[model samples]
Target chain A: SQTIHQWPATLVQPVGSPLSLECTVEGTSNPNLYWYRQAAGRGLQLLFYSVGIGQISSEVPQNLSASRPQDRQFILSSKKLLLSDSGFYLCAWSAIGDAAFFGQGTRLTVV
Target chain B: AQKVTQAQTEISVVEKEDVTLDCVYETRDTTYYLFWYKQPPSGELVFLIRRNSFDEQNEISGRYSWNFQKSTSSFNFTITASQVVDSAVYFCALSCSRVHTPLSPMDSSYKLIFGSGTRLLVRP
Candidate 1:
């Protein structure tokens, strides 16, 4: 069975702080990875996705960006955090014609 | 543009009551995919079901059933004899076939777009 692991399950960052959230997948190779954000009382918005190493696509340009440094390792980073960046960030992995599996998610609070 | 609409923002149901979560989608592509996901208070999304455009067959798994209607572009989920464990936010998503082009930039068509989600509260 495949499993997705995300770190810093909960994070509290001051405004203008740097942000780094990591996600990794095990038991699968060359899987599609994605980053999604959900604001309080709102639906999910696609942030970024990657098909392979060094291939990242931005769904919505903002303060955040994603990078696939390894085949199953994805990282979401920002040079500076904004108050609007507070939300639940989810990392997901999927194959073609299959259901995407999500991680536990990172609840980021910017104060 | 591919879009999924889960109009019901929230639903409340008593234990053992039957409930249905509606999902409506819009897309120009003839071949696409639909999915239902469950997000508990813990907040990780659990994959529930997946259906393709060509298959409109309704599926039932234990107390859960899915109704896929191609004519109406709707895929709805029903829970029979719901329990407190079923309390969660259900999301409906639409995805055009993945175009695994490592060289090409991905567009909305190759993305798994999600709806706003419906929060289901099953009280015990």
Candidate 2:
């Protein structure tokens, strides 16, 4: 069985602070990883996705970035957070031509 | 470009009643995939079903059923004997399939474009 772990289920940070959210997958190798953000009452927007280490494709131009340092470790980061950056962040993984599996997600509030 | 449309913004139904959520999609590619996911108040997305473009056969899983119509570009989901546990926001998503191409980290075809979700509320 595969499992994804995401940290700090909830976080409250002041504006302009740096942010780091981690996601790691177990029981799978070379899996596709993705980062998504969902605003309140809105659909999820894809932020970034990676097929391998050191490779990332960004879907939107925003204040956040994503990196896959290892085969199963993905990180979402921001040098400075904005009020609009607050949302529910989710990490997902999938094999080629398969449906995605999602993590529990992190709720970040930028005050 | 690929797009998914879930027109029902919200729906309310009493327990034991039947409910259907609509999903319509558009894509230029002949080969593609459609998916439905559920997001409860807890906010984790749970994958419900996936249907390929070639397979129009409707599927039934327990109390859940899916209708896939390629001509109409619609894939609808229905819950029979709905319960409170089925209350959640449902999302429809689409992805294009590219054959024989190496899976690149930069390939846009590997990405899924999601639609604005429909929130389902089942009353006790």
Candidate 3:
């Protein structure tokens, strides 16, 4: 069975502070990884997706960025947080032509 | 371009009542996929069902059922007997199949995108 781990389920940070959210998957290799953000009372928006290490495709142009350092490790980062950045961040992975699975997600609050 | 439209923003139903959630999608590709997910108060998006474009056979799983009509580009979900535990936000999503092409696999076209979501509230 595969499992995804997302750290710091909830975080409260002041505005302009750096942010780092890590996600990792086990029991799968070379899987497609994705990051999505869901604002309050809104649909989820794709943030970034990676097919392999050092390869990332960003969907929305914003202050956030994503990186795939290892095969199963994906990190979402920002140099300075914005008030609009607060949302539920989800990490997911899937095989080719298969349904995607999501992590528990991190709820970040930028004050 | 591929898109999913969930017409109903929110629905409320009493326990033991039947409720249906509607979803409509648009895509030029014939070999695409559609999915339904449930997001409860826990906040995790749980995959409910995945249907390929070619297979229009409706599926029934316990009290949950799905109807896929390709002609109308609609895939609707229904809960036979609603319960408080079934209260959650449901989302419809679509993804274009990875057609044989010279483009790199890393391209984001194969990625899945979600609809606006419909919040369902079942009163116990």
Q: Taking the tens digit of each residue's C-alpha lDDT, what string does model 3 give over A1-111?
A: 999999889999999999999999999998889999999988989999888899889988999999999999999999999999999999999876578899999999999
Of 1 and 3, the candidate ahead on TM-score is: 3
Measured on C-alpha atoms, candidate 3 has an lDDT of 0.92
Please report how far candidate 2 places residue A48 from its true position, in Å.
Answer: 0.7
- Clash count for candidate 3 is 0
For candidate 3, the docking band is medium
Query: Model 1, residue A103: displacement in angstroms?
Result: 0.6
C-alpha lDDT (0 to 100) for residue A16 of candidate 2: 95
By the DockQ metric, which is better: model 2 or model 3? 2
lDDT of 1 at B78: 99
How close is candidate 3 at the interface, in terms of C-alpha RMSD after superposing the true interface residues? 1.1
DockQ for every prediction shown:
0.73, 0.77, 0.77
lDDT of 1: 0.92
Scanning candidate 2 chain A in windows of ten residues, the lowest lDDT window is A92-101
Instruction: Give lDDT tens digits, candidate 3, residues B1-124.
Output: 7789999999999999999999999888888888999999999999999999899999999999999999999999999999999999999998776743446756555688889999999998
Superposed model 1: Cα runs more than 4 Å off: B98-107
Measured with C-alpha atoms, the lDDT of residue B19 in candidate 3 is: 95
